[model samples]
Target chain A: MFDTLAAMLDWFGIVVFTVTGALVASRKQMDAVGFVLLGTVTGIGGGSVRDMLLGRLPVFWVAEPAYLLTCVCVAFAAFFLAHIPASRYRALLWLDAVGMALFAVAGAERALLSGTAPSVAVAMGVITATFGGMIRDVLGGETPVILRREIYATAALVGAALFVLLSLAGASREAGLTAGFL
Target chain B: MFDTLAAMLDWFGIVVFTVTGALVASRKQMDAVGFVLLGTVTGIGGGSVRDMLLGRLPVFWVAEPAYLLTCVCVAFAAFFLAHIPASRYRALLWLDAVGMALFAVAGAERALLSGTAPSVAVAMGVITATFGGMIRDVLGGETPVILRREIYATAALVGAALFVLLSLAGASREAGLTAGFL
Candidate 1:
């Protein structure tokens, strides 16, 4: 029913990931190239891996170069805006959680549609939700947040599992999506 | 002219890369899971990305699951044998160079076969030869060899460039392959 809104949220997820990637590069005092590289990779790495794993050809960003362009711009701008307010930083954190959860459900859905086992679909969800950030941190020479923390991937796990279970129970996909977000 | 030999060399390249990855993970003191993860990804990451970008479906490893099994075995064994003699380590380093050169030429050849421009083919070559190690270091929280030194990717770049130039000059594909390793 809210396809446009869902699309907007998905776009926000990419932006949020890009911003975080750029911010992390700033923290590392990396050069402009570094900032852009980290940002673009963080924004798209997880989904790209997921698509590749599922044999989705050309991956998403290759099929849609605009996503790559948007990530570059967002990252370049972030280099200058690194001193943004702490309040906005807090807001970003909140949005990032929403983004990761959304990604988890989305990844599982894709895997299920591709006919993988439920267990593997759940793994796909966690990988989609957290891998981009993990890669960003790795490139920035830091330990990945996924390995350091409990909550990040656990939340994605819960969402992915619930989505699969709900789908199995013959619930509408829309309802499962709502449950994941909640 | 020596297709069988070339294929064998290619296989050796994968094994060498896997060993290097596992060794790096061992040096990082990562667990067994980490060793396997690093080794497998390092062995396959570059080519997988190349395929995805070129829209090659199902990826090579998924089509040949034996590659995955071999990587896992090699990585696990490396965990126990990490303390091997420095001479062996030196041997592996030399093998790695051969592997990288072989991969660079192989990658360019693949891209060229797919009808990409010579320039893009060369880029594909370097990406194929180096991105796996780059990902391995990033995952290990070490600065990537590609970023820290001038030589790592320069070697790949040279090999890739040579391969493309020779191919364009109407030399034998075999000539280009020879040049890459030389």
Candidate 2:
């Protein structure tokens, strides 16, 4: 049950991330290919880097084309959505935060499952949460948001650490996930 | 003999890449931390990405701290050298080209040794040759050098293909390396 929930949330997070990527491209006056490339990279770039660092084979997106397709679909949708009024910028921030929270816990859990130390798991969680945004900003010709004076990476670090501590305290993984998400 | 030569070239390339990264940081007026971060990423970023895609564990710099140290040293040196004059820009470009050529063949050879198909190996070589500069450009808030109309990625592509073809035609690996370098 927890696994299913996590998978669902992961897909949801991908959608949110992809939309933001596309939105950035549209704001930059980029074409379709730019939107798709940025969307795909922002949605999957972090987890792919994490998996590679852990030596997981076939990288996540390579093993599953569905994820790549989702990124493309959402990017296309965002291309249309970008025509709407500018107030949606506020919605983007909130959506990004929610997605970031979800990914942080999931990344930590995956690290723990893969037998990483608690510290490493926490770092993985943070990386998974923020690396995509970092890549997105960089590709968009800006400094990474997390590296700047944002409350972003800090939030990810705290949540990931909380999750890892809970797990190390012998709490159920589900309980840790809930706490981290909250 | 080939192994030794490859190793030496790899280190030389790292120094060149690191210097370029540091020079970019200087041009951007970044701090020490930025210089180090950019330098390290540019120096090892390509091989690290390739190894991860191939499921090679721990990434190269993570497994061997020496590469990271070399990047740091070169970055520090470049930080000071950046103030000298504008004439060094010419030298930087030549060094970058040499480094790119060396890394292309080395990346291809590594992929071939890891048992990937020749096509995949060639792609890996292109990636290894181009990825570091791509990352550095992104971090420095510029379009990637490869994405622009430069004789850059094309050079890496030709070298990688030449090396792979030479190997397939029953030439010694050293012969392939030398031919690819030229």
Q: How many residue pairs clash in each candidate?
A: 0, 0
Provide the global lDDT of candidate 2 against the true structure: 0.79
Q: Which regions of candidate 2 deviate over 4 angstroms?
A: A1-47, A57-130, A138-182, B147-149
Compared with the true structure, all predictions reach lDDT values of: 0.76, 0.79
For A100-175, candidate 1 gives per-residue lDDT tens digits of: 8878887777777777767657656766877888878776777865444436666887898898889788898788
Per-residue accuracy of model 2 over A32-90 as CA lDDT, tens digit each: 88989998898988788778776766677898899999999889878777778566556
User: Which RMSD does model 1 reach against the true structure?
Assistant: 6.7
In model 1, residue pairs whose N, Cα or C atoms come closer than 3 Å (at least 3 residues apart or on different chains), thus clashing, are none
Give the lDDT of residue A107 in candidate 2.
Answer: 83
- The segments of candidate 1 whose C-alpha lies over 4 angstroms from its true place after superposition are A1-45, A52-109, A115-130, A139-141, A145-182, B1-7, B87-95
Worst 10 contiguous positions by lDDT, candidate 1 chain B: B1-10
- lDDT digits (tens) for residues B47-108 of candidate 1: 88888778776666655556667777888898888777465546545655766887888788
